[model samples]
Target: MPLLFLLRLQHIPLPVRVALSEEVRLVSVLVATGLIEADFAPVRPTGPDAASRIATVKRITEEGLAEIAKMSDAPKFAKTSMRFARGLRLM
Candidate 1:
């Protein structure tokens, strides 16, 4: 769902969307590893309010990171993945 939304965001090209998706997945992993809290709530963009929409996602992501940082266990989260060949093809 989030990936689809990322794909549709106008200012963000396909590569950027892919990067953001990977970041989100890493965020999810951190949450799963007890390193942060995940925002399970969905973000629905109504119109052309790009700034607000981007801010919404960024805020939630930052907050989740903060929550994880406060945890004593602070597990090492995995990094985001990339498909270099696929990205090259897209380019």
Candidate 2:
């Protein structure tokens, strides 16, 4: 699954986060399922007055990490990453 692959790239870019842009549909699914928690900040992408807001991922829930750990294609260390991921902050 995308989420599992996403987690695998945590250290790839030298920091956190797998992707800079995420589809709204996928984000909704992840949020609704309690896979991750995020905070939305209003952004005026089109104009200064635009009320549009963008959300950034804060962290992945323990349950979410467990879900990743169960993935078949996940890294071999995925199962043992729960503790390390618990306090991790996703940007």
Candidate 3:
């Protein structure tokens, strides 16, 4: 399966983030329902190996959140990206 980059963008700890990403499709779904072992497959190398990956995702998310906060009253640039994605359906 493809790695879901978006799935890792939460403000929690590394292990917990990886634990969530391994199975859930979106963070909202994870938050609304809560994490269960059955909800996510067990992450391998459970000790410290997955830490950096999770940390990087967390840092990126924090940066994104900072940027979004600065634009709280503006339309997000993401709307153009979404529009382009929809346009792709016609090509």
Candidate 4:
């Protein structure tokens, strides 16, 4: 989910950004609780090839977002609490 936030803040490919956004919406509660986890593999060129390594990084990011969605949901209590606070002008 932090990846999603960073993607939204940077100039990245639209499709990748959109995928991240959708994943974030699907797992916002885990994000709010700071429970999302992402594994960033180290980049190593196998045969003087760098482009494929970059693609691997992108794929890893997408997979991480998918895992987050599968593990989280929007927390109902947090939403309701925020609404109640706003009603009292304490937000």
Candidate 5:
């Protein structure tokens, strides 16, 4: 699910993705393996709204897709497979 989401959605914020079911663990694993970088610090909001804080968070690396292709458990659906194939093109 996380893999598919990542494939379809570009520039997704890390906090928002973690709110998805079971994605926190998946994202953590991906981050640990250098597939994703979570070093982004969201822009601090002047207002007290929590939503604004969440909206500012983001994390990514240039090689995110390529790293996903190297994973053994990459998603198998056609769309995801096609993306993975493309990701592997430069390898």
Candidate 6:
């Protein structure tokens, strides 16, 4: 899988600015919702065998891609990619 990149364009409210842990929770929720699939791991390596992680989006289900496309086509989400994605960067 490719690495996800984030760009901070401006300051969003504290409520909207989700922490890494919260973002991971949201990704787990998304996976539970069947919209996408992800692999979870520690933010910082705990051991030599530990893997780096950031709730990587290993793959998007067909439904997930369709939903994303639908979101982009919508008026509200068209220009708000980051918000629409929550904290996960789409590939």
Q: Which candidate is the best by TM-score?
A: 2
lDDT of 5 by residue, 1-91 (tens): 5565455435553545343325544555556666565432344556553322122114545677675565435445666879878887553
lDDT: which is higher, 1 or 5? 5
* True lDDT of residue 30, candidate 1: 47
- Candidate 2 has an lDDT of 0.56
Off by over 4 Å in 6: 1-19, 42-54, 76-91
lDDT of 3 by residue, 1-91 (tens): 2113333333344444443344344433333333222123334566653422221122334444544455553456578778888888653
C-alpha positional error of residue 24 in candidate 1 after TM-score superposition, expressed in Å: 0.5
Instruction: Please provide, for model 1 over 2-65, each residue's C-alpha lDDT reduced to its tens digit, 9 standing for 90 to 100.
Output: 3233323323332232224455565455445554333543456555632221221332345444
Extract clashing residue pairs from model 5.
none
Worst 10 residues of 5 by lDDT: 49-58
State TM-scores per candidate.
0.27, 0.49, 0.21, 0.22, 0.38, 0.44
* Error at 75, model 2, angstroms: 9.3
lDDT, candidate 2, at 34: 84
TM-score of 3: 0.21
Deviation from native of the Cα of residue 83 in model 1, angstroms = 39
The per-model lDDT (C-alpha) reads 0.38, 0.56, 0.39, 0.41, 0.49, 0.52
Candidate 1 error regions (>4 Å): 1-19, 43-91
RMSD of every candidate to native, in Å, equals 14.9, 13.8, 12.5, 10.9, 11.2, 15.1
Give the distance in Å from residue 68's predicted Cα in candidate 6 to where it truly belongs: 0.8
> Where does candidate 3 clash, by residue pair?
none
Higher-lDDT candidate of 3 and 6: 6
Q: If both were scored by TM-score, which would come out higher, candidate 1 or candidate 3?
A: 1
